[model samples]
Target: MTRKDNSVARLYRLAQSARSGQWNLEHDIDWSRRPRLPFWMRRAQARKALSQLYHGEMATSDLCEALLADATEDRYEVRSCLGLQLQDERRHAAAYQRYLEALGGIDPLDDGLQRALTAARHGPFGNLGAMLAYHVVIEGELLRLHGVLAQFVPCPLLRDINRLVGHDEARHVAFGKIYLPEAVQALSDDERRALYAWLEGLWQDAADSALNRRRANLAIATFFRRWLGGGWTRHAKALDSLGLPSATGREQAA
Candidate 1:
């Protein structure tokens, strides 16, 4: 066979192996029995709400497929990384499914998750780079927020679930680091400018989501009350740690 044929074969094999590794969602999670609830019912509810967000992984995978199909010829690595990300998201969704099943077979399909996905799909930065930035930068910020929430939850089972989801998120951030800069480098000056503008808009959206007053207030009054005793001050500190601005400040900057 020709050398070019060999190269294609190798790449195809690598892609197959990577995809196969991420296929079994049930095998990865230890769903031996139902998890016990925490002392704070609100904290339990928050966990349930967060788990619902994972239900949108199918939508995310479809988006990723679209992005990958549009990837330039020289971006094979980026495509491979996106494939891995797709697998990880599927696994994450499965893990969350198990957690939800444990919680009285609840399926979390709330307006919040739907709104977030819709906003992302319709964002000013509608290209691959914008999607990458949102996943890496924006989702990375959300994972940090999840970490804070996990700390506040008294239930060991819920904390374990958060940690598992966080692990997958970290992998996604790594993939973003791999592709985002390369994507930036490939763009024209105008495209770069548009991307930067998109980044700014996405950053504002993330800040608003993080410091969502109603959500924050509900979190504090319920599950996160122990950690956020100082109220908005503590919450602001958490947002700062994640490199996010307060919602009010983000609006002002806009």
Candidate 2:
């Protein structure tokens, strides 16, 4: 088998292994324990941010389903990995929804995240761009966000959720990293440029939304800014590695 074939085989193995690694929401998280929300986190602004995150999980699930629908049988390993991720995303959305209910009912999805969801659902790009946008960019940022939440949130239940979800997200991102390089080699210049444009807009929308959220809540401004910086750096590196145009430098300025 070629190196690309080996990578796909490995991804399939990882997906199969993920079956046993999965945690049950009802059993794994100790719901009996009391959840202590920090004073600042209890505000409406914080709740809104959490609501956006919850909605993101739902959006990810939807995107996974879309990706799976378009997947062909030729790429068995890749399709299997995506199928596993689809299940993971659904469970993540359910977990986040329950967590939101414990804090307060879910809020309306933020405009930025809502825009992202729309793009993921109805983007003009082909399969490669969709995977790059959803798996590499969105899920990559989400992996970092899960770490941030796990570390910052005092509640054990929330920490557990982040830990478990982060593990699955890491696998999803891994699939993109392994698969995209080969797929990108097949793209025409025009297709690459189109994808870069689409992803640029997606990145900007998310940054603008995050900035708006930060400005609205003074208490978490530092956290938001730091998160944005990390996300920009991650995007820059991913773009460079993928041989795509690096627009994150411009995003950093904005």
Candidate 3:
């Protein structure tokens, strides 16, 4: 396998960056601040969004656990970066849970997120697949959504939470961007195709979730399409760069 010795520095820097950026969910967040739900976003919608966000953060922690459990000593830098990500995910989940409590407690996990988590846990990709599914696909989508919420949501606390959490998530996605190409290059063509197939299934399961299909004002809906399309395009390019199968049919199907 080809290893980029230079990436060791980058990975170490990422871990340090995460450590420096860590904040106390209890003290850092302005818990007393309340959400100002816009007319476009109903109270129910806001609650649902937070609930889903909480669950998403928790699922990411689970993915980190899966990755770390299978992590080997040889990949010290990679594991170190992922270890910090596990910390970030746990903090993010707790922050969201606290936010939900202020907003009248957590709502049920969205069906789409639940299904996506289930598929991720049972998927055939093993460790490499786990990284691709969560770090690459899911985190990319989530980062975009977080940006949108930060911009549109009027709540001071939600905005603050999104900013901090998004910072950590961007790093997670960066880890995938830098690592996946090099790691995937060692795979056989058949293996690459299998990876793409697994990605396609996971993407479909997530895209069809209720969170993505939520009804909203036309302007917000349009914004979602634009942001989500950009995310998909970027993810598709990453796959292409990795020599994975074309996602054309899957894109059209979505």
- The global C-alpha lDDT for each of the candidates, from Candidate 1 onward, is 0.56, 0.74, 0.75
Better of 1 and 2 by TM-score: 2
**Model 1 bad stretches (over 4 Å):** 1-24, 69-75, 105-113, 154-164, 188-190, 206-254
Q: Model 1, 101-162: lDDT tens per residue?
A: 66656555655445555667776656664475457444644565566656655556556666
Compute the lDDT of residue 242 as modeled in candidate 3. 54
Clashing pairs counted in every model:
0, 0, 0
- Segments in model 2 whose C-alpha atoms lie over 4 Å from true places: 71-74, 212-226, 245-254
Best by TM-score: 2
> Candidate 3's residue-wise lDDT over 66-164, tens digit each?
778874635878888888989999999988887877778889986776777777777786677777777767766667667667766877778888888
Which candidate should be chosen as best, given lDDT against the real structure?
3
Worst 10 residues of 3 by lDDT: 245-254
88 in model 1: Cα distance from truth in Å? 1.6
List TM-score per model, in order: 0.64, 0.85, 0.83
Per-residue CA lDDT of model 2 for 1-254, tens digit only, reads 99977887788787787777777889988777655667666546556756767887888777768777764635777777777888888888888888778766789987777777677557787666667787767767766666666665777877877778878877876777777877876877667667777887888788878788668677567767776776756775787577665555435544
- Ranked by lDDT, the better of candidates 1 and 3 is 3
